[model samples]
Target: MTDSTATRATKPFRFGVVAPLTTDLPTWRDRVRRIAGSGYSTLLMPDVPKWQPAPAPTLAAAAGLADLRVGTWVYASPLRPAWSTAWEAHSLSVLTDGRFEMGIGTGRPGIEDELRELGLPVTRPGERLAQVRETVTRLRELDGPDLHTPVVMAVRGPKARALAAEFADTVTFALMPGDDRAEMTRLVRDFRTDRDVELSQHVAVVGDSVAPFMASPDTDPAALRAADSLAVLPDDPAAAAEEIQRRREEIGFSYFVFGADFAEKLAPVVAELAGH
Candidate 1:
């Protein structure tokens, strides 16, 4: 399908895998090399605590592999001071030769307890937006020559989405609860038409072996197929390609990210669809 005029052809199509931050060094090192060799565009790390490893070092390790870009899927903003993240992200940018993109967010729900345990302040929407803006400012000021880090705003709310559109290098319309493929597609179109920023999407890639474990509660294979084009399926390469190309045409989505477990499963699809 031909892209809408609103979609800029200058934006490139790319693919990424969201790796767990908590993974051991050796496993992560091996997986990152595998991801790069498999033709994925980038190897990403999630900011969630469950991912046990730290994002900065993991991203650095993956950067060591030849020609692989690194980034965060999304980082919880209220968990750390804006200056801290800004400093660390620039450090990452330097370490990775400007291949780092900071994915900042308002933060996940159910994080208050963790914040209190760490004696950190739990910020509201207004404050979090302020932090996003300030953090971006600090990153630009601190970065070395020709080393400006790209910012990926993980839009979780209206204000957050607006912030991303106005300020971020790219805006990701995450697939949240109650979101189906159609809604995601519509949002992608709207964002593309309304903003000049690049677009990204977050979804799971499900192969036959991984589908069961990756399925959401009460979601079956038929349900997933019925829901939307969110999960990239092994059996439906044509459908996957169609959905991917459709989004690319409409929204100029150069970045597609999936969880690490399913990243390998998506290699062939990436091989077929990337950069087209």
Candidate 2:
């Protein structure tokens, strides 16, 4: 391992919860407060349109209700123009008093179909990556020299990883339900060989329950365990904390993001490990 990767485990640990507004305003505010009170560092909203409210306004509301940071689980680049996305991100950063982290990516799987449905151009992979780049560039320009809004990038392919290495403050290796753990470790190791950015992993399952929208509803916990998937965590707080530390030591992952449904389940682990 390179020197940077070797020392990666020494990075402080922080936790985030991905939550969308699925209830009344009061209920959502309560959830946001509870998440902050539970020792979470950030509250994130997914970029899915129609199925949920827009991420910007929701995140603004969330940030207002709690002292915790706020961000997008990831903004899909193809959803809107780069300037528009960057403008909203810059506004959020300013409104939140620099507490907003911009999480962005080309888009999720099958984004082509979504684009087609919305009558937006269905660009190729390279074009989508360009969009991400443009959005980040525009965001930087808008933020000016006085402020730097942190960027969190969720990446999967080599090209995306390269772009993330260039611009991301935090990087998340987008994992599928059954992706090989060894390969992921190698990828992360390679990514960290020269840079010391914070590494985040999205936890889809805590114990036997899979968080909604994180994975298929029928996703089998036994199957994931048998495959040694990194997307699942133990239910017991002590066990979960142990595994999280092991992951940081072995794979250089120090930041963990959990879906809202199981954020409470992992709060104990968060309470024990956050800021450590």
Candidate 3:
């Protein structure tokens, strides 16, 4: 299990880096090494289209690096068959020695639209949540690998959050514009019955205000869309980091999913807060 809960319960803070899966594997591994070396505990890579280069190869390649834990910032639940996702996750779990985590959602309109263009179901959140739950169950049944990887549910509404608390090991959210921190906290504190599960938070970059500080396109399409649409900050990486920090405090999100473009530029910000 990921230490997100332990970090939340005992530690003062938790930190992670968002890998730009868009880059080459070697480069992504190098960056993951740096982030892990810098004391960040987790690395998140979101899912995108097959044609779109992403962080999966890099995450698999970096599996042997120290004790770093790897996670998918998110994977579009409605795009592909549930079993395919389960098996893919099982492969990563086996490869990463159970250090892999996955973020899942019914998928946003953009993803649904894209998948529909390809003749797939654009499942609504309710149907998708049920499918996701089944997938998680099936993933747990895999025998060849350790299959100990956890699933972090990404959802926004009350019903979805409740489902996540019951089925997922962790509950996550993309802190888009107008996200309600108070509401989120309330939802988590109330809906969760599993004492073992943890809650994770995510935020995106909006504009030049925090553009340079962002890593790049390592995050999944849903998150990328959220960041592109909501995260508006200064273009200078440093300024963007500062702005991102400000927003983090404002929304009460400890786990941030950033782009690879702002990695070096935002390093200072992460350093100032995490010191790892």
TM-score for each candidate, following the candidate numbering: 0.84, 0.96, 0.72
Question: In candidate 1, residue 27 scores what lDDT?
Answer: 76
Candidate 2's residue-wise lDDT over 147-224, tens digit each?
899999999888998898888989999887677689789878767445668889999888999887677788888898
Query: Predicted candidate 2: what Cα RMSD to the true structure?
Result: 1.6
RMSD of every candidate to native, in Å, equals 3.7, 1.6, 6.1
Q: Indicate whether candidate 1 or candidate 3 has the larger TM-score.
A: 1
Off by over 4 Å in 2: 1-4, 7-9
Q: Candidate 2: which pairs clash?
A: none
Residue-level lDDT tens digits of model 3 in 1-276: 233322344223456666655567677667878887766767777666664455466567666765788877677777667888888888888888778887777765456678778788767667887778777877878734534678888877767766776777776654444434454445444454534555455544534323322324443434434444333434565765565555444433455555555556656666766621
| Candidate 1 segments exceeding 4 Å error | 1-7, 21-24, 192-195, 205-224, 229-235
Ranking by lDDT: 2, 1, 3
lDDT of 2 at 182: 90
Which residue segments of model 3 deviate by more than 4 Å? 1-12, 24-26, 54-56, 64-67, 143-147, 180-190, 206-254, 268-276
